[model samples]
Target: MNWRLIGACTLAFASVQFSPALGQTDIQSQRVQFARGASSATVKGTIKGYAIRDYVVGARAGQTMTVKLTTPNTANYFNVTPAGSDTAIFVGSTSGNSFRGTLPVSGDYTIRVYLMRSAARRNETANYALAIGVTGRPAAVAPKPSVDAVVPGTQFHAVTSIPCKAAPGQPTRQCKAGVIRSPGGEATVRITLPGGSERNIYFNNGNASSSDARTPKFSVTRDGDTSIVTVGAGERYEIPDMLVTGG
Candidate 1:
């Protein structure tokens, strides 16, 4: 069961000093008039009342934190200041009910949420539950791999490993190339693929391990009856079926 454990107090927002001391009591409406946003803590959704956390799970101090927000139809203000620092890192109006900022220092931060006016009902009550959290900045997202085309006439296939960063933009390959035979079982080599992916595998047109990202780097494409392979990008040809031909 996936459950969101709240680390701090569940008490109303107004109770916490410098947290989100604003007008309009914490209403029960849709739990803080939900608006969508992303922060170190959670994903896409309107957070009624929450805290800023790390963008990356279990992110430690010294990591940049990304904070985002959306307010839909209300005027509001939010700011974050690193612990022990007197100046707020980012402060501005919700441009079109949306806001975003990053925090540098690590520690307990004071995220103040201020409303334009005060209503008899306090801010904590559910007109909207503004959620804040701290998280590590997002790492580079890897590109999605395309579906591999199967060999036309047979279920069996072949592939060759390509280096990620080959000699100054050149792919990584065995310092010495040729019929690399494994002493007992299979021949394996350390090779990098097109996007700086490294893998060591006994490649010869075999099974699923062909594309195992960690290693076993091999080119695999099934475009009709022709299966091609080039270790140095058309410089060397890895015997398509070394097991059979021993080429």
Candidate 2:
């Protein structure tokens, strides 16, 4: 082998071995310590670009832990990972910036803070204050009853099928709907659409509303025995008076 060719091969091998290490990001971890006789702690830090910081706190099973993050960057979020598991049970981005729940198992739970990929790639920086608290002793809780155990026709106070269309020009389908009334005269109507998806409409004090009230195009109308409700632009449902009054 020629000397120049041998030197070129060695340089290429060196680049292949060390290139991944240069691109990898290392996580900085800090242990959380509560004050004497206190169960809570607040820590402040700054992270830029793709840097990540993990705040580890020791907690026992069944102890309720609360974590709240305050930052100016909307892309920054925290995730609570339980002991011995890589999965996070609580995600701050979807669940809002605060979390309060009883931990499942015991060990050092990691609260990972980082920016989203979009913001990280821009090399943005976030100055944040993380508040963490652990309270209450380990206690067992009884499992509550499952809502799926309620039979659609028998358990519901009133059940019927109604004509509905998901959008304009869509073929109408007979959707199964059920109504459950409360002592306060408020009623909840659960409607099952063509593909088994469910929509819940509420009736209170003579007004009808759906869970998503943010839609600006919602309207209700009546035609003889049927009450036509439209959510958004074209999703329509016709509810008969008999379903509300119970014939």
Candidate 3:
């Protein structure tokens, strides 16, 4: 790492301390925490070449948060950096399966993960898992309808009502990924935009993915004091707009 990058990392860790979401208890409490003294935030991941790095401290506009890999590996030599504002903070290089990057954009960013081949383990493939946190408390939960049964307007500030009998046979029902309920499940919802950029929203916390496979991708391009989401699956009672109040 260069002097400028090293200085940034030092300043970031030295100046800010992250906060864990309170009352947001989940199942993966054991896999989280640094050493008890670091903080009580708990985010868990069970993927290769990656894991939830750390909960950033004092995450705000114009701030840079660095996430580190838990272990180092040689098979995977590097990482991916997002484009545009997303690229401002990113996975720069390979440091023993660990990395140093900043959070440039806010409202749920991602670390594009990949793997490299190893000389000894010639067929080595990576299946990484990761998590996120901030220096400040997680955003408060907004009371949203568990299931909306109505059509909504383009600017969806109001919750659309999903009638119990909206579907033809009334045989299907929707499912929700409660923030504090499950902390180990994974959801891979891909949403493509007009700009040719796709957003891969992963919703895990145990309740994220269901056996029925009814989950949605949540993303915001701009304009919002609130976090809005929409489910992608065609389940009758599927709800994608979940509240992120807990870790």
Q: Which candidate gets the maximum TM-score versus the true structure?
A: 2
Superposed model 3: Cα runs more than 4 Å off:
1-60, 77-88, 92-102, 117-121, 125-133, 136-247
> What overall lDDT goes with each candidate model?
0.32, 0.65, 0.28
Residues 1-247, candidate 2, lDDT per residue (tens digit)? Answer: 1112122122211211101011246589999989999999999999887888999998864477999999999988888876654546577766778998655444688999888777877888999999999997642221111132222213244566778987788988877776544434444556777785666556553346443323557678988766798977788888876665443
Candidate 1: worst-modelled 10 consecutive residues by lDDT: 138-147
lDDT (10s digit) by residue, model 1, range 153-207: 2111122322233334454353211112222223323333345333232333331
User: What overall lDDT, based on C-alpha atoms, would model 2 receive against the true structure?
Assistant: 0.65
Report model 2's TM-score to 2 decimal places: 0.48
Better model by TM-score, 1 or 3? 1
Better of 1 and 3 by lDDT: 1
TM-score of each: 0.28, 0.48, 0.26
Q: Sort the candidates on TM-score, descending order.
A: 2, 1, 3
RMSD of 2: 20.1
